[model samples]
Target chain A: MQIYLPIAELPISIFLVLGIGAAVGFISGMFGVGGGFLMTPLLIFIGIPPAVAVATETAQIAASSMTGAIAYWRRRALDFKLGGVLLAGGVVGTVLGVAFFNAMRRLGQLDLVITLSYITLLGSVGGLMLTESLKAMLSARKGISAPLGRAGHPWYFGLPLRMRFNRSKLYVSVLPLLFLAILIGFAGAVLGIGGGFLMVPALIYLFRVPTAVVVGTSLFQILFTMLAAIMLHAATNQSVDIILAMLLVFGGVFGAQFGARAGQNIRGDHFRLLLALIVLAVGVRFASEIVLRPDELFSLGLIEIRR
Target chain B: MRRAALALLACWWAAAARAETMVLSLSSHRVQITSTYTGAELVIFGVIDNERRSVTRQEPYDVVVTAAGPRASTVVRQKVRLGPIWMNLAQRKFADVPTTLAQISSRPIVQIASPDLRRRFGLGLDSILDPAGYDLIYDPTFRTALIRLQREAGLYRSEERGVTFITPSIFRAVVPVPATAPLGGYDVDVALFSGGVLLAREDTNFEVTKVGFEQAVAQAARQHPIWYGAATALMSVAFGWLATVIFRRD
Candidate 1:
């Protein structure tokens, strides 16, 4: 089936788009990542305009995060106090990111910035995940329980404006949490991500939150952050493609539902390793495009019609 | 120039002999862009009334048909290697360039007209790009890139010797409009050339417009962006809720 995207002014295969959404959604649900690291790049590979892909993907992320956050809310696993503080910083970061995005777009350098950021982010995160998961898998096979590592460094705890988050059983400084949230928030807004991969690790390692509560807290913060991004892109840039967003949301919501059940049957360490491999593969492919010469060195864009 | 003048005089005499100079029609004048619009082809056919002229040994009349979509500004960006990566370094803006262009002729355009004539009529792809209208500096690569990219995208085409003559005075050509072609008024120009000179010319209009659901959606997205944005967010959230409801039953 062929569907015409109004904003992008192009016709795309309906089934192809649905399949991409489902695949990314399944991976995100199974691994507890937001999947934007994979989804935004895939959308661009399939010829969706970069601006539309970024804005529309953010809209879809907002929808998917809402579903995940609700499930965690029902389970009483979300740390509202920590999530709220992160969101406060996230709002400020999103505004700055939007301005930066607009500036890059005007200079015709937005595509370069987006590709470079993805390459940097996915490369480091995927590499770390692969090593950590491999060690965990090896330890499990040897029938040895690995002791829980210390969550935070002394400097992170020494920051001012300390607050107690009873839900995670941690008393952490608000400054570090706010600073981390701002950084992730900027990344989420610019990269069209929910920042789950970055947030989950930060929550567990930097703030010393319980691993059990990290996924829920990350999803809660991501929901609000992506919601703000969607509105900003729509109102300011008018780049969000509703048709594209709806198709992705439809496939993503259903895929995540099925994926969650499939996740229950798999070993945690094995799935983590698999997801890490996929992330690293995507990052490598992105990097190769930059390091390699393009088939066509020149490109054209229709002048933006401002009414 | 002398030959062109004689050809014009002959065409005037032929027109004086008959009431009709030429008759032109298209397969479709209004192209409706529905949800299933993949592409379209217009069969441009015309009849030349050469009734008064003797059917003796003479040069066969050549047909050249050109179609251009609505004009708009376009920007072409050239990438330069900067350190480790290639980035957009310079941009050239072109004004009044057609979003889509298709030209079909009975013979190779070069054979039918001289370089000056081709440029004057905007016949061949190379010379059709108006040099005076672009930015201050004249770079041949930018012009070539613009046409090359558009052609690759199926928005521009030049099909030499594509027109066929079924009868002595009737000719037809098929012009293809790609799926990505913009929606607007398309101008089709048909010219009859004899002895390498233009004899008779006719102009027709082809309209491509969005209809039904496609029109409504495109209009709302452009005109009422705030409402459209709110609706998109709401719909996405609803989809998520619907999925949760369906799956939670398990």
Candidate 2:
């Protein structure tokens, strides 16, 4: 069956959208990733406008991050003190990011910027993950623990505004944490991602936070940042398609449940390897799209739709 | 609604009487786009007065029907090789371009009329762009690219031999409304030709509008966008919470 999306002003097959949402949600649940990077490109490939795809996918990220945040809250894994400091910087980053996004859109450079950002970020993240997981797999076969996460102290530890985080059991500099949050928040707003993939590693290695607490803290900050992003996109660009978001959420919610269960059976190193491969494949696809010549050079843009 | 329909019919009749050659009528004058609206199909039927000419079975009549949606300004962009990647380099703004254009004719448009005549009548995709005062620095290939892209999107289309003659003077054409069709007034033009010359032309238009739930949703997103955004965020959060509650593993 086909359903008409109101804001996008198009009709898409119901099953096709649902299936896309479910598959993205499954990966998100299994890997604890928001999957916005995956979903946005797929939606654009299927003919949704690039602007609408970017704006609407943020709402789905907000939804999935909310679930993860609440679960972490129940377990008392979230450090509200640290999250608060990060959110303060995140709001600033979101404001600047939205302004930059509007400027790029006006110049008609948003698509190129988004595609290039995705290629670079995904390429690096995937490459790092592949090597790390392979090393872990090798170490496991030899029955020896991998000497990872020991890069000594981060350089920013000596920065100003040092504060103690009770839950994380660390006395980290607030300035660096706030700066990292701002950078990730800017990326989240502009790239339409949850920034978890970027934040998790930063929290673990740079801040020396425990792995147990990093995921929850990242989710908490992402929830707030995405909330700001959705509202800003709606107010400024008017690109949020609620009907599209709802359809995606319906499938995503259910798929996440099944994916979480499926994730328990797979070994951690193997799961990371699979996710890295998928990410790398998506990055390669995006890179090739830019490198290859387009089938058609000129494309139409609808300036207005008269009612 | 009935009164409006009657008024439109009266107006069409008045226009037809002035031409005194052909009369055109659509199956419906209004298309309601409800929540479940995927697409629509309308049938256009018309009659041509062949008594004026001697009917020797020598090409009785040729009918061409065009359904053109409301005109709007749009931009066409071209991608160029920028270093190692492709990027949008050149763009042109066109005024008064139809949002949706579907042409159905008894035979191929090229066979029916000359290119000059077709351009004058605004019959085909080639004539859609108005280069009146705009600079012509861009290559004509840009226009071809625009048409190709529109055709792929199912917006601009020309179906040769789409019109069928039920009788000698009576003909009907099926006009398909694609799912991506914009909401607005769509003008349907029916031209009767004899001996490769235009006999009479009838212009009738229909309104495609969003109604019910679809209207409400689209309106909210446009008008009360802030509240709509808040509501969307809140609902998403609630949905996420509900999912976690229902599917707790441990």
lDDT of 1: 0.83
Q: How well is each residue in B172-204 modelled by candidate 2, as lDDT tens digits? A: 999888778888999999877655666578899
**How many steric overlaps are in each model, in order?**
0, 0
Q: What is the lDDT of residue B233 in candidate 1?
A: 78
Per-residue lDDT of model 2, residues A1-307, tens digit only:
8888888888888899999999999988888889898998999999888888888988999889888889888898898888888888887888888888889888778888999999999999889989989999999999998875766666788788789999888887889988888888888788888888888877876787888888888888888888888999888888888988988888887777778879889998999899889889999999988899977677777777655
Measured with C-alpha atoms, the lDDT of residue A68 in candidate 2 is 87
Model 1: CA > 4 A from native:
A137-153, A304-307, B1-21, B49-57, B130-139
Tens digit of lDDT per residue, candidate 1, span B109-174? 988877756765677777668663233566689989999999998899989989999997899999
Q: Which pairs of residues have clashing backbones in candidate 1?
A: none
Worst 10 residues of 1 chain A by lDDT: A145-154
Best by TM-score: 2
What would the TM-scores of all predictions be? 0.90, 0.92
Model 2 off-target regions past 4 Å? A140-144, A149-152, B1-20, B50-59, B130-138
